[model samples]
Target: MDRSPFPHHGPLRPEQVTGRESLAVDLAQRIADRRLTALVGPRRFGKTSLLKRVAADLAAVGPQPVWIDLYQLTSMADFAAAVDRGLASVVGPVRRALDSIAATVALRIGVLGVELTRSPKYRPDPVLSLRNLLGVLTSAAQRHDLFVVFDEFSGVANIQGGAGVLRTELQHHFQSLGIVFAGSEPSTMRALFSEQTQPFFAQADLVEIGPLSDAAVGHIVEDGFETTQRHTGGITSRIVAFAAGHPQRAMQLADALWRRVEPGETADMPAWEAALAEVRTNVNAASERIFSLLPTGQQKTLRAIAAGGSIYGAAASALELPPGSAQDAAEKLIGNGIVRRAQERLEVIDPLLADWLCRRFPI
Candidate 1:
């Protein structure tokens, strides 16, 4: 059997990743130069994959990569544990120091290689533990740079004084550490870094990740099919057009297309349609759940935008909504990262969700 060319889940390999090469290279170089960066983008837009590429590029010559994912963390204890976990995963000098410190504290490191076990009588303040760990790691940075990537860094908002704790601890290490704070929630991320009252205000440079180019998506599609002895038969362009440069969606459509054709078979019009049907079927339940969670006004606004109807024009009137309400709904959608302004037109950020909207509520 031929190896599958498309990855269905998780971050793509650093070399296998496409469309974000230049951006990744630039980010890696900046981090090596000891710059703090805030990387923001929509969920599943390959932000993690880009970070992985950055990590790979910096591995041999620059700081050691320490990845800490803060998604769904509920307290400072969880945050400290996450940091400990990330540190435990590192090799070389950092890992050896962690082992020695864990022994001294009566704690255990390298349990299952990624888990840190706390001693019953040796509980320390979570915030203090986090600060001490950073102190140790950043101290080591004087000898070997430490590049830290905090994925879903905005989730820290859920922990009381989380941002303050991080800011106070990390500020002192600016000269020695390279940090990239990344999150998928655009509005929350903006509030954390851009708002004057926020603790991280002016702390890091901002970088926004957008969709991949259509040409790049097409290249991935063609390469995947041709390498597997299957021909696209001119269907690659249609797949690219529908995917609208979304990194995951492009690979998803290509995978669906690949499943429809056998070795040496050409994917013609019928095969393309069948693949689309399959893709739609796979995402139907998810789309419905997302649509059901929206407010009525947002639902109406989404349908109008998906159908290419004016949100605050006759479409709003027909939906029995005032122009202002439509505008508010559109803005809310944009803030939530569900809809975006593309070329001065409102477009749904998720092309699959947009397709579901139009199909579920026809114009």
Candidate 2:
């Protein structure tokens, strides 16, 4: 009833009644026991949010919690620098624990001569720097039991095989430090951690986050709209259905609808329609950028698959590309996390993304 549709920043908490309490508690227990955990889900399904909540709960018990988003990192050095920055921000005992490493590592702020008041200079290798930092953290954890959550872990894939190496090293050196890995790209993360060829194979418990239930979605919408005196009705239901239980989309749509509501006026169907249209537009822009990066044959193959409503051979001949080309492109799309294949049928990962592909490709 705060008149704001936006939920709290970071992650939603367990008691938030957002319908992820069971999973949050499960993750909390795993971290508490010093177990590594991987939380995987489609984009905006609350993977990061759930992990943030778990981190908060863990912090409440003892060991300080540190949250890092790998997406913001481009290389191992960047990741290490980020870890240093994140750890330096920790206060009290956690801050003191990092002091020694910070001195030895000589961590700095940036290219400009900015030093971390009590922090160390930035190290060149993030994995090694993190390894050394974890050594200090492990010693501290023995006294305080720290929890570290790495969000958007899928970005580690972009780190030139550093993902595999980092996972292996962390598993070896920091088993005592509680670790929670969360990523929007579940399939990619699974391949990294579950695939036998990868370093993290079966190294951590895998937690797949699915869509929220109708009741949970309803609660979030109702509570969000309550501040504006808007009753939960068809409008909320339609929004939820449109989001298809995606937590990020649901929150985003709610935020949009709230902004559209005039003072003392309830949100109407037109507002929902307008919001969906905007979402579609944004999705289209993103998809177009990705599609443009593909080769001509790959683009044609995608269109053909979209037109045929499947990736099976029936559509191959129409695209004028070789059957193998279409199949290969399909694999590439799936591997790049741009498309999803299930039951031998291919579709864009998100509904909004699918709508964009349908509009641009127009098969």
TM-score for each of the candidates: 0.93, 0.80
- Residue 193 error, candidate 2, Å: 1.9
Candidate 1 overall Cα lDDT vs. reference? Answer: 0.83
- Consecutive 10-residue window with the lowest summed lDDT within model 2: 109-118
Stretches > 4 Å off in candidate 1: 98-124
Writing each residue's lDDT as its tens digit, candidate 2 over 1-363 gives: 354665634565544535888997898888877778888776667777677666667677765787666775676666665565566667876677567545565643232112222234552445555565555555556566677888888877777766665665465545567888888665678887888987778888888787787778777887877766765446988877766666776777777787777656777888888877876766676777877899987787667655546545666777776788878888877666666655566765565655666776664
| Per-residue error (Å), model 1, residue 52 | 0.2
lDDT of 1 by residue, 76-183 (tens): 877878777777778888677666666665555434222323552555667777776666566656667677899989889889888898888888888788899999
Clashes of each: 0, 11
